[model samples]
Target: MSKSSVYSWRIDPVLKQDLEQAARTEQTSIAQLLEQIVQDWLYKKSSPDDEEVQQRLHEAASQTFGAFRSRDSKGSEKVRERVRAKLRQKRATQRPD
Candidate 1:
């Protein structure tokens, strides 16, 4: 491991208690647990160009929008139509001078 540096971060008491319990359950120190957690988060955040991340993002966007073939969207058409209708009705009620 590289030389450890002093990086102090403050967390809430309840979360701290939970972390401590998790550390105890894992037979590790709080520092080790936090280090592992932070490392994992860093790995995920920094892997935007990774193949797995790219594939997952593409899959999610495709699932959300792939079926949108017409002028109206597929999944959210009802909500969009309702909002547009409400907006038009509201506009019609306005006084245009």
Candidate 2:
């Protein structure tokens, strides 16, 4: 266990009541809930900016782009044609002679 210290501050009675209710609902003590809230806020504050996120997404897409491409140059059109053909074959097989 780590060392702990007590800190007190004034808050509106209604807000205190809401905090208590929330802590009870979460099955945690008010101190623990407050600690978790502070930790989450710090984590979010340290997250990457929008440009960094976009750069990361672009890098990932570049790495995986055309990874599943078919031999044909028009892979998407070929895939659609193959799917339609399979569906037609299935429907024909299900029909009575």
The TM-scores, one per candidate, come to 0.48, 0.50
List the pairs of residues colliding in candidate 1. none
Report the C-alpha displacement of residue 97, candidate 1, in angstroms: 98
Summarize candidate 2's per-residue lDDT along 1-97 as a digit string, tens digits: 4747878999999999999999999999998999999889999889987899999999988986766645778877677889999999999999999
Query: Which candidate has the top score in lDDT?
Result: 2
For candidate 1, what is the TM-score?
0.48
Look at candidate 2 and tell me the lDDT of residue 65: 73
How many backbone overlaps does candidate 1 show? 0
Off by over 4 Å in 1: 49-97
Clashes of each: 0, 0
For candidate 1, write residues 47-67 as lDDT tens digits.
Answer: 675888789998988877744
Q: Rate the local accuracy (lDDT) of all candidates.
A: 0.86, 0.90
- Candidate 2: C-alpha RMSD to true structure equals 9.3
Residue 4 local lDDT, model 2: 75
